[model samples]
Target chain A: MASTIAEKIFASHLRDTPTPGDAVLDIDVVMCHEITTPIAITDLMEKGMDRVFDPDKIKAVIDHVTPSKDSKTATQAKILRDWARRHNIKDFFDVGNNGVCHALFPEKGFIRPGYTVIMGDSHTCTHGAFGAFAAGIGTTDLEVGILKGVCAFKEPVTMRVDITGTLPVGVYAKDVILHIIKKITVNGATNKVMEFAGPIVDRMSMESRMTLCNMAIEAGGTCGICMPDRTTAEYLWPFIDDKYESVDDAVKDFKQWHSDPDAHYDSTITIDVSDLVPQATFGFKPDEVKDITDIEGENVDQIYIGSCTNGRIEDLRAAAKVLKGRKISRNVRGILSPATPSIFNQALEEGIIKIFMDAGFCVTNPTCGACLGMSTGVLAEGEVCASTTNRNFNGRMGKGGMVHLMSPLSAAAASIAGHITDPRKYLQ
Target chain B: MKQFGGPAIFLDRNDINTDEIIPAKYLTENSKTALKPFILEDLHLEGFDPQSDELKNAGVIVTRANFGCGSSREHAVWVFEVNDINVVIAESFARIFRQNMFNCGMLAVELPKEDIDIILSMGNVDIDIDVTNGVITAKGAGEKTFNFTLNDFARELIQAGGWLAYADKKY
Candidate 1:
């Protein structure tokens, strides 16, 4: 079988043929947030597996409930903290510095080009931006992965998404993904490996690439990846000093991951973003998206500008620019949460956060807060919202809290206007 | 106490997402107690207040398109089932949510928005789901009938009473 890129990553990680099903892949990096680790640690303890199967490969952070607002969140934090101390997790980050887990994991150089990475969080697909095959695993899967230090898998069929031409001005990476979801629906990518190609994807920043891969799960793909090049090296170099592996090794382990010039796909969808605007969800599905311009008078009570998707500095910058010198309207609650502690610190240094807070936005410490509807950002039964998070399912944020998923820029714009508004008004 | 498919309750809201179903925070430690309280909390802001006697009054939730969207957290399905909500009548459903529900033997029934609206506005009406007939009939309100798409696996799960119920037999 002519191995695909997904196969390459799997082969590179494969240790000696261990079991009938369990193939040990050389872990390039491991990622975790609070929720998955406590149980993993507990499982280990129950099994009397005191030490981790591997520590240097571990990167644990507390972002799911970083601020620890509720009793449950607080309990989760202490559990993670104690786990970090006991395991001596090298990349452990405390709450205040913790932003979103996936955002921080890559921003901090936990991912490298031509590497195989795993994260306990479902959004682990976010790491694919660095040219790694990353996917979020369930708790049982992660616990097993940590115990034996490898994961099992069947191969994913390759699917290519060709997004050509320049994406519109206000149309950031989020829109491209939303547009793809609109085409592919939610289950369109189910069980397929999507390698985003076309010159347009190459032009996108690593952060933008992260945004694309992050939402791959929304479409039900195991993970979405972009093959690494010089851009991958530039981003990886600053984040790590280690011999973070070489491209030659990458080429050796698996064939360079690209669709065969005439490669076949289970399905191939083309997205045209040149005319698309910043998109948002109108209801309980990421696929339930519409152009921001379409929802003119909808009453949105909340506007959330964070999550693994749009919780980066670029997201913050876009939101800040929209709300610059203006306050969120009284009828609207502008909620912002940065993705990582490093991203938050950088935002602070750049005064991006000041712009957001000064604009009357209620910012939460880095956690997957309202984006998941467990935070202060949830809406009332009849309230509407404009958010930058993935998914818009019923009761997603809080039942009766209607979600209108959009880009960070649109979210910020909607926050200021108290309704869904096009981000192009500010970005242009 | 009933397995009747119709007598739907309209929670006619748009964009009911999964994050709101079981927030990522609760996914931290897989415990029954942690998930039970927060059910549909994001769906309604108060979270799902089980103490409020929600489980006793089982009713159908009629929602807009793309209901139960996002994340494959079975917690979302369990929360609803434990709360006495067996039927999710939506114009559409996220594929994952449907799968999760089907695996657990929950009902994810879809119909046109117009039929859903008619039942909601008419109030307290009963309906019979005739799977073999490929139709759902409103109790007495002008004899409205609706069509739905029921996949084989989904039908099997619901017939089995949810994924746990199904797993018991399959395993």
Candidate 2:
């Protein structure tokens, strides 16, 4: 039978022919962060296991709540550092050198086409942009992956999301994804793999594609994947090892990674982005989205443009384009955090940091800061923030905080307006 | 993983995410005791607190669709386990949250929407679950039995006291 990309990846890893919902022992990479790794390492130690199955396959990063917000977090980081050193883990990225785990891992060539990656962070699905099968697992499962080098997975049904039209000038991948999440409720794609296809996906940059896949969990999807194409090969070429002579060779090697023409999907949904407007979440859930123009003016106290979802260099450039000559409203405290150190350095070289600073934005080091309400730029009670992050759950930024999820352009526009506004108005 | 009975507390809300179950603020602590008082504290349900006398005494929780959505934090399930919540019945659950529950040997039963509504209407009812038969019996007003679904692997994991114990035996 013809198989979807997800099925193909699963079957390649399995010894037997794969079927939907079949448990398979396939995991290429296991990753965790400061928040979740301490528990998994402690569990491993308690089990009398002194070393991980393979230290090379394990990736540990200190991204979330990094720089030690409190004594508890500091101790947790210490535990992880001690465990990584003891295990001789080669891929450990400490607090200062670390970015968001999801973004940094892919840039370091840890994720590749047709590989099955598992991480303790839900945004591990972000790696699926490179045509890999990546899903979030709990700390216990992470421990299992570390010990056994393989974790069990119940195959997920595939949902084909075909975007048929070109995105408008001001609209972004964030808008397209938020629009889809609104059409499909929070639980609409529960336990399914979302396979993105059609023209819009083909034209999207790697960073934008990552932005789309990063929030697949928001709609309850196990993973979100796109076919490996020239763009994917080109984006990974620089970071990839010396094995591949050229980008064309890498693309040629993964030629079979695409879904079969006759592949059977459980369901198919078509979305046209031609007339789609820039979107922003009006409520707590990411699905509660509205067209930027439809939302009335609501004062915002903060504006954040960074996360695994929208902290890439492209996102920084988009926000910087809007804030170049203008200052953010005095009532609003704006923040810009790049997704990785490389992206941060690129932004600094491109003078995006200077533009943000000129616009009165507080530029912070790369972290999952303020996105999970863990540390840095937390909101006070009843305060409102326009963020480029994926989730807008209640108090996601801080206690009693109201979050409006939007594209970086929209976030920058809101920062200048002190209220939700259309980015197209500020775009050159 | 056999027969078990407990008082059921109704959380009449949908999409009860992990952040609300145990907010990110409390995730720094690794101890169950440190996370106990804050169970469902951030949920901010009208007139409901997981630590209240009414909830503290209850062992089963019934909720609406997509319970335990958002974030892969298993601390959400750990918080419930520490609070003595043995089972969670919902119309539906986020995939990661359900797996997290099973990994910890806690029961997360999925009932039909109508059955969940019926259970929620009955205040402070005792629920008897038969894991082998996948049935939930509510002892209130009149005896009502509802059929639920549990995959075979999950049932085995629960019987063996979660993934760690199951792994111990299998590996």
Best by TM-score: 2
User: DockQ of each model against the real complex?
Assistant: 0.15, 0.60
TM-score of candidate 2 on Cα atoms, chains taken together: 0.97
**Interface residue Cα RMSD of candidate 1 after superposition:** 6.9
Q: What is the TM-score of each candidate against the true structure?
A: 0.75, 0.97
| lDDT of each candidate versus the true structure | 0.70, 0.87
Q: What tens-digit string does per-residue lDDT give for candidate 2 at B24-117?
A: 8888997766888888877857888656787888888999999999999989988888888879999899988898888888899988889988
B1-171 per-residue lDDT for model 1 (tens digits):
235464555566655666666665567545644566666654543344434443336455677876765564556766776666767878777645665565555677888888778777776566666665468777654667788767555565556655433332332
Cα lDDT of candidate 1 equals 0.70
Give one digit per residue, the lDDT tens place, for model 2 in A299-336: 79999999999999999999998999999998889999
Off by over 4 Å in 2: A15-20, B1-3
lDDT of 1 by residue, A240-354 (tens): 4355476444444333654345645666667767777777777556787887778776788888888888898888987787888888889887877887777778899999888
- Model 1 - which docking category? incorrect
